[model samples]
Target: MSALAMNETLTIARLGQRGDGVAETVQGQVFVPFALPGESVRAVRDGDRAQVVEILTPSASRIAAICPLFTRCGGCAAQHMGEGLYAEWKRQQVVTALSRAGLETEVLPVVDAHGVGRRRVTFHARREDDGMRVGFMVAGTHDLIEVQACPVLAPGLERAPIVAQHLANRLRASNKPLDIQLTASEAGLDVDIRGHGPAGDALRRQLTEAAERLDLARLAMHGEIIVERRAPFQLMGKAAVTPAPGGFLQATSEGEAMLSRLVLDAIPKAKRVADLFAGCGPFSVRLAEKAQVSAFESDKAAIQALSRAANHTQGLKPVAAEARDLFRRPLLEHELNVFDAVVLDPPRAGAEAQVKRLAASKVPLVAYVSCDVGSFARDAALLVAGGYALERVTPVDQFRYSAHIELVGVFRKTAGRK
Candidate 1:
């Protein structure tokens, strides 16, 4: 490549979906990280990807990053942008998705749900001769960046890196890279270590001692309990739920509550509700307060947890949980008719098969919660074509500083739809 081609000064025109600033060049388009729109920057280009060397003219929306390791840690993007631009970028993600789907509806402003940062964090730990390196991976690379502290973590989990390091040091004898998942719960820090093989009696004893010293509520290796100081429970609405080891939880408690509220508001009068793809009853437990809930999920452990929570909790309407894969056998139209409304929170792939059945069903109201905008748009288009009115969508800023945005889209079946 020519020197001029490799080293070029470019003006950022817009931000891409992954939060990279896009610059139109004669060679097509270049994507530069840590650069904002309307800013002129000098970058070293390799094909269409560029590394920002210097910001010649910074945009008005540019701001100093709060975290020193913002660009290097790969945990957050767009942190350099001001709050106004950041919020608009997140909201426009949903707007762009809806526009692509050929559907236009009022989208509420993005809700700031990233309160006090993420409650749960996963650290990548690799054993070394000196000790263990524990933290997140560098952007687009497998290089581990040892984080001393993270601003994005919940206050309760401020010492998570230290906790993870302690566990890693104790388990370093196994000589295995580990993924340590830490969740700050009511009891204490719930620790789940993955990528480690079955622990022998000696290793188990060491882990137990480490857990005790670190004051962990629970410690599990490969989803099997090594030590349990207390039940690491999370309160979902009125009920207390002990989620499965290393199971999915919303990044922040505030995000979970906001999503639940939006989902609840979408189906205000729903007496009988089906919580599809329900994981550990975050929504089901809340919905059960006002409606009879049938929660279906593929994870047996999660369903069991939900079932146990519902059975023990008092004053909640009947909540029945079943372990069934909705992708393979979605609730058919006839089976779906029994519910007054339905709330489905599918994974990133976005529940195509299940949505097809929902479109054919007589369920009057459907609230779709999605993490991926592209998949949501595709599924929303399907529902819109199937005699459903695309109601207002509210985008939730759960994963802040990143391109990912969660949305709750309400769809109501048109009149006279059988």
Candidate 2:
């Protein structure tokens, strides 16, 4: 390889975050996008980027990407890899992160999904002179890209931004102030709107009339805008929109079901459980059927959803929901002993201080769900150093084709401890 070369091929050796193909050519680390971990391929080592040119040796894991927007859409990155391989890679990603962090113990099996289920997606939109431009964030930046279709819309609002923009234009023609939300639910289109500038009777009529044209079932309006009576719409059989802005929850019902199952199974044998960072009762409601669950989340709005979920379940024990900033103020060390098992579903940052306290609190078993492998590994090492034995690690494909991977690992307290 010369100091300055236009095009050169490099064999990929491993994987990294952002779903890149990692390789080394004595030039530090070269990451190849769109290439799997174990592929001996001709990748053009561009200045800051690498592209797969030819595959000399392909890992059994490589598969044809199904989505048409595999290269264009920024929603997911690993779609081109085989479904089974994708799952395996995800598991390995966590294991690698953990192993490097000094938790070089047994990493368990992983589960595969034919298609990653994405329930909800937020699209960016703005009114242009010609038409309304709408789509997802650009690959590396927040610059929005206009798109016709997305694989991740919950259901009813599959073409939400497009449809909403059209309605907004009609309202504009009729001179109405318009803010809109089109929620996806099996129950159908439930919309909400808030407006202040223009919506007169004519604009309001136009907005509702446009929604009627789209065959929407329920619609509510405020000022010059039409909005869903409730946000997020109810999923499955629920009767309300229970999503908070930017607060993490499963985007797809299928994903939620899969993720919820993992949390429930993590501590199946336990009686009393504490579900940390339990947002909107995803796992808490599911686990409630089998065990007494105490749920905790930082957001009060999320806690409200958990409270409602607890009230609705029949045989399930309503989870005790508490709202607190676990980062700033973690669960007290003494309080960790109140449960037989502790289940944590933290965000990408993973559980550190909480895991440290759990290890010190003498909890018998802990199941942690994490989005970041590196963080999971670090936290797992802390637990292991504190004498927690690794039991099982399961990775689920929630967001398919992307660099992001979700994992659930169960750790048991080491035996014969002093």
Candidate 3:
């Protein structure tokens, strides 16, 4: 391509789903990062992607970014969008996805569940020629951007980057890449290190010392405990749950609370509830407070943690926690008859198999929680085809400033049980 063709000033028509600005080029649509709609930007063009060289005309909805590493860090997107534009953009993501699936319904406004910022973060560490470099990867690139602090993290994780760096320094001799996941818990910071094959006794002892020095509650390597200064826990409703090392957790405390509230509100009078793909019983333990909950998940450790939390907490109804991979063996339609309501918080792939069974079952209500809109829309279409009405969908923003969006959709059986 010629220099003029490669470097052109383009007008951004709109924002794409991934938070990139869409500019119609002669070839097709070129996605430009950090550019907003109604703006003219000079960019260095690749095939279908472009890097913004200058914002020739800034959008009125553009605002100053909060983080110094905004574009370079790649951890956040849409940080420059004004509050109004950002909210609408996120909500429209759900609306657009559902519309494409031919399942149009009331999509409530986007809920800002980013209160106090994220409680969990994973820092990537690489041992370079100079030393160990620790931080997040740049967007679409493997290059690490060294981060000292991240404003998006909860105050409890204020020292996360420093702690990660210290841990990296300790393992620099191994010369292996590391992924350090840190979660701020009720007791203190809970950390798990990955990619450090097997820890020798000497290394374990050193990690124990490092954990103590860092004031960490617990430290583990690949889910195996190396040190336990204290049992780290998280408060879910009235119960305090000590999750499995480095297990899945909602990004923010407020996000979990918001999602739980939405789920609870949908099935107020249900006496029996089934929590599917339930990770560490975020919804199961809470749901047990009122109804008998049968929690199912593929992670045995998470189920054990959930059961222990339920057994220890008083005033909650019986919670039968079982370890089962729903993707392979979905609870059949007849088996689903025991529960009056079902709540699913599946991963990004969504619960296609489980949802299909629910679609044919006699279950009255379903509170479907999803992180990916496309997957959720596909599953919702299946449920609707099975004679369920998607009452409404509420989008929750937990990973603030990022393209990620969480949502809770309530489906009610409109036709008699098949």
Whole-model Cα lDDT of every candidate shown, in order:
0.92, 0.68, 0.94
Q: Tens digits of per-residue lDDT for model 1 on 1-418?
A: 3465588899999998889999998889899998999999999998989999899998999998889999998889978989988988889999999999999999999999999888999999998777888889999899999999988888889879999999898888778899999999989999999998999999999999999999999999989999999999998999999999988898899999999999999998999999999999999999999999999999999999999999989989999899999999999999999999999999999999999999988889999999999999999998988889988999999788877799999999999875
Model 3 lDDT, residue 202, Cα? 96
Q: Residue pairs in steric clash, candidate 3?
A: none
TM-score, every prediction: 0.98, 0.80, 0.98
Model 1: residues >4 Å from true position, as ranges? 1-5
The residue ranges of model 3 lying beyond 4 angstroms of the native Cα positions read: 1-5
> Considering TM-score, which of the candidate structures 2 and 3 is the better prediction for this target?
3
How well does candidate 3 match the true structure in TM-score terms? Answer: 0.98
Error of 1 at 349 (Å): 0.6
Candidate 3 steric clashes: 0
Query: Per lDDT, what order, best first?
Result: 3, 1, 2
